[model samples]
Target: MSEKLGAERLMPNEWRDDLEALDLEIVRFAIICQVKLLEPGVIQRVLDNDARDCIHGNQTAFASLRGLLFLHFQMQKDLAEAYGPSDATEIVRRVWAHLQPRVGDQLGSLPNPGALSAV
Candidate 1:
């Protein structure tokens, strides 16, 4: 979170606060998305692209980095453009919850939602 904005260092506390707020918003949207019970197509495309990268020799670690970038930046951008920011936020939340449990269970550990968001 110490990334620079222009010349000033991004304050750690403020960055964390922003991240936490984002996490809460995402959680709320996720709950709403779950009620709808269908994965947004945009999310699917992001996952698909990640899978393609893995198949083309991207290491798991790098693939994860790419996935994060796509989800937080690209996916949000695309969803917001197509559906507006508020709706896009909901989709992000839904996609987060939808993906997390499935991936975690497959790896034999169901992550507590929000457990690692602060880190």
Candidate 2:
């Protein structure tokens, strides 16, 4: 028999849009880090804000973005542990490039995370 569909399965197309927005946020963060140095605390705040907004009204998309972000950080940490600091930045750059296409134009005009540091 076919699996029964639940109410939760009926997500609106907006949620996909939200996920794409979240992806753009991640890409912005990566770009800022590339151009200028950002403090760790600053980076954390940006990620926290993105996660919070994503979580507030859209749980499913938020959860997915959170998971992806977590995995991204974990993989970066693992690579750092294995290859040393010199290689960590390059790995992160490549990862960000891979993610950019997936997010496409959904990012809108969100501020770069690094810019937040000055505020």
Candidate 3:
């Protein structure tokens, strides 16, 4: 058996730390789903649901719990690693802005970390 599969290693595409650069055509096409694609709020809900399942002793909850924990911790690590925890709320607001493009930028861009305004 061969050590390698039928493939060649492609270019490494860690988006050089600038979210804005994704606006370019080539850069935009080179989409990679990272923490950017996930909405922290939704991840929170999934975590919450998984916790509840754990409480109820769902048969598969243990595996689900482990994955969720990794995801949870990873998100925390990502925040501390990329932008300090202080900026977590701002990140959420930026998500909200994308969610409601009709809203004016100034207002839509306000940071409401824990509190999502009524749509």
Candidate 4:
């Protein structure tokens, strides 16, 4: 990844012109997983309160944004309080905790606890 920060991590097209909550969830998932699964834009924009633009004027998108923000802050506070000041290390652990590895991801890598490798 580039040495640049969050917004800098995104490709031009990765940014969502829309502020739908589901769309923003993609970004939140990226953050929690600690992997750049998407070319995510900056979290600052994702967290913007005034960015609510729901199609049909429904509140789902706005509600989703609120939930996402709550989750982000809660996780931040939880990790800090639980793990002390080891942000980097704790983040790695958090990523793995949330990881849903595909078979391809594990074919030759991580071993399953009780499963034998195919010969």
Q: Pick the candidate with the highest TM-score.
A: 2
TM-score of each: 0.32, 0.42, 0.29, 0.35
RMSD of 4: 16.7
Judged by whole-model lDDT over C-alpha atoms, candidate 4 comes out at: 0.37
Better of 1 and 4 by lDDT: 1
In model 3, the Cα lDDT at residue 81 comes to 48
Q: In model 1, what lDDT does residue 102 have?
A: 45
Query: Lowest summed lDDT over 10 consecutive residues: which window, candidate 3?
Result: 26-35
Q: Give the TM-score of candidate 1.
A: 0.32
**Residue-level error in angstroms, candidate 2, position 11:** 38
Model 3 regions lying over 4 Å from their true place = 1-55, 92-119
**Error at 36, model 2, angstroms:** 19
Local distance difference test values of all predictions, in order:
0.40, 0.43, 0.34, 0.37
Q: Candidate 2 residues 1-119, lDDT tens each?
A: 66535322323333234334544565554443331113334335434644333313444544444455555465445444655544554544444455546644434332443232122
Q: After superposition, how far is residue 13 of candidate 1 from its true place, in Å?
A: 36
True lDDT of residue 91, candidate 2: 42
Of 1 and 4, the candidate ranking higher by TM-score: 4
Collision pairs in model 4: none
Q: What 10-residue stretch in candidate 2 is worst by lDDT?
A: 31-40
